[model samples]
Target: MVDDTLLETRHLTKEFAGFVAVNDVSLRVRRGTIHALIGPNGAGKTTVFNLLTRFLPATHGQILYRGEDITHARPAEVARRGLVRSFQISAVFPNLTVLENVRVALQRKLGTSFHFWQSERSLDALDERATELLAQVDLASHRELLAVELPYGRKRALELATTLALEPELLLLDEPTQGMGHEDVGRVTALIQRVARDRTVLMVEHNLSVVADLSHVITVLARGSVLAEGPYADISRDRQVLEAYIGSAEPEAAV
Candidate 1:
């Protein structure tokens, strides 16, 4: 059988001072799907994300992207392989305008990233593509404003736009909706849906509603191990998943 998985982790584990944070967790994120990693506080969700992006070295196991072991790869190497993580690599300059922030990412494709002496026309050439990326994240109208000038929620939107500029095949989002107001959450939820039409997304989100709405597969982590894995309907009713969330094993307590 052919492997449709875009990202896979095998026996992945992490430790800090002999305390295991992620224990033998394996994930299979298929192509063109939204996969959510969720759990209660201190379940090692972010640690798993850091491991996948190479921000933190795993104490054991393997990471496979496009069927190749990336266990020892550098952060830039993982990103260059088309597995990009938002907020880590997306350079959102506070002083630059929204469009300009995205233009910086686009400049890499033009091979003029380090050419400080490049002409204004060379940089301006990125404007059209940058504008399109802004449009993708519903930031077109705010393109002229400095990233710092935008409201908190729109600033996150700009970050999303800049990440999209890299044309990633697999996007890893760590709490894409954290610290947002209700309106901002809705808007970003919609934006995630829009951008995920073509590429796959592997996200660590705390918002169960957003996870239920966006994720094609959900992996529930508890005490540094996978408690359960399935659709939201199944995971939500799981006793173990419920106990991990609310400290009660009542199946109806809701995940």
Candidate 2:
């Protein structure tokens, strides 16, 4: 029988020098869903990403993708299996033109990445694919511009386009809208919703509104453990979640 789960973890734990950064956290992500992980600073959100992507070795437990164990797979090996991550910080080639940045990513996906000496024009298929991705992210207008020269928000879009070039089944976004203005945040939110139409997205987002607007399921983490996990409405009203992460309200003085 085909496994229904796209990703699952069993007692997933990560430790640093005897300090448990992530403690026995188990999660299941269904295929083709947008799942959001939310928490305050230092709540082990990034640590979870590191462990899942194999940037850091798991102190214990198992990570399974499509019912197969992948706890100790190397980062590239994990990515090759169709799981890819976008870092919280923008990853782009600053000196390269926006089109060039995405073209390089497309080349990697097409198995022609080693052809460094060949002219980019020789890879017509890669160029075409990259152009399509640029359009999808609404960065086609800035194609010839230096990646560093584009506005901050557009830079994020460029990063998204680059990740798309990899053709991932699961996209891990680490604060995709961080450090953006209101308008930019709205744009990125819409872009994410568009992307989620076809791919599963697992994100660690601090922006409450973004989480409420984009997430189909929300998992709350506090002090290295799950405080709550459910649909938005259920988790939002959870008293334990409110007190531990959202803070309790103080009584107002009589008017």
Candidate 3:
């Protein structure tokens, strides 16, 4: 039988000077499942992401992708290995049209990322695949618009489109729905669901509604440690999760 785990962290820890941001956290993300890392303020959720992506070197621990230890992998190396991430803020180029932005991402796979000086016709081959990605995120009609002109929710969709252009095996999303009203939240949530159908996703999200809807497994962190781990059904009733995260209105707004 094949091993189903796609990503795993063992004894992961990160420190800043003398401050412990993430403390000995170990997690396993099974293949093709949506896993959410959630917590209240200062729970070290983003710190864990930084560690996983190799933005910060771990003080102690291990990061494993497909069962290989990757504790010291560089950010670019990690991304090249089929693990990609989207940010909390919109990351598309403001002046570029949605199609152009996605086409730029596709250029990475062709090994011509800095060839913008080339003829426009040279990159036209990517247009068809770019359009398919746009349609996947429901942004096909907005393909001609500059990314800056899109509404915030639509901008996020375009960013997702660009990320998909890289063909990631495991997508890491940081607060994908932050700062959105109910309508945009619903749209992005559905978009995440659609995109997650083919690959695995690990996200740090504050919105319980989105976490409840999409997460197959939920990990709760508190004070830089794992406080709970289980499905949403079990996590919802976890007394510690309720007291530390869900019971407070402010926590829902946390990043």
Candidate 4:
């Protein structure tokens, strides 16, 4: 059975100073599946993310979320439509405690006024929700710790928890496992898989093994155009994909 599409790009293109970064590329992400975008450095993976999230306006294209055109929607509007992205680098508030950071996210999700004089009791429910999110990311023990004090891997986990607080229907991750130890990578890989069970995920990942392990669909990009796309096994073995992106290395276990 064909899966329903949750997000899609039609002829998505981005150009700067007459140089195209992403060229007329169309992609679809199935609802409740993990879709991975892989390519060498400068293949325009990040550019595509920016376009989808409206961080960067498309040169010419349409972005559709749940079949509604949101081509020029603001980032927050897109997010409110159940599309949220986590950056490669951590975006946590360094001075805020882990629980506080999650609480802020929950408040945003709840659409509460940001006035300082708002009743503290109003946020109690948000705090409880935040605590539940921290537990999901395995950071319940560090809830009182400052965001900057946590180790890098834990920081990444916290970022995921914050994104989850948004209650996204489609999640975009940028190099989620970047700069992590092998064990940390494995842990994050598992977390991403668990999240994918509920929300559709689209990621720009450099780690071939992670893509192979998590992606139900793989789209290979080279020089701003799609080189190949299919199941991991087929795309990983395609001659053009290997020559243009994957190179000569044997596939490694997902980690």
List residue ranges in candidate 1 displaced over 4 A: 88-91, 247-254
Q: Which has the better lDDT: candidate 3, or candidate 4? A: 3
Q: Which stretches of candidate 3 lie over 4 Å from their true place?
A: 246-255
Lowest lDDT sum, 10 consecutive residues, model 1, at 246-255
Ranking by TM-score: 3, 1, 2, 4
Per-model TM-score on C-alpha atoms: 0.94, 0.94, 0.97, 0.93
Candidates in descending lDDT order: 3, 4, 1, 2
Clashing pairs in 1: none
lDDT of 2 at 250: 18
Per-residue lDDT over 1-70 for candidate 4, one digit per residue giving the tens place of the 0 to 100 score: 7649889899999999999999989999989889999887789999999999999999998999999999
- What is the TM-score of candidate 4? 0.93
lDDT (C-alpha, whole model) for all candidates: 0.88, 0.87, 0.92, 0.88
lDDT of 3 by residue, 1-255 (tens): 988999999999988889999999999999999999999879999999989999899999999999998899899999999999999999999999999999999999999999768899999899999999999999999989999999999999999999999999999999999989999999999999999999999999989889999999999999899999999899888887777854556646332
Off by over 4 Å in 2: 1-3, 246-255
lDDT of 4 at 102: 92
Deviation of model 3 at 215, angstroms: 0.6
lDDT (tens digit, per residue) of candidate 2 on 1-255: 765589898898888889989998999998888999877677799999999999999988999998889998999999999999999999999999999999888877568889889875787666677889999999888899999998999999999999998999999999998889999999999999998899999999877788889988888887788878999889878887777654423111000
Q: Model 1 Cα displacement at 252 (Å)?
A: 16
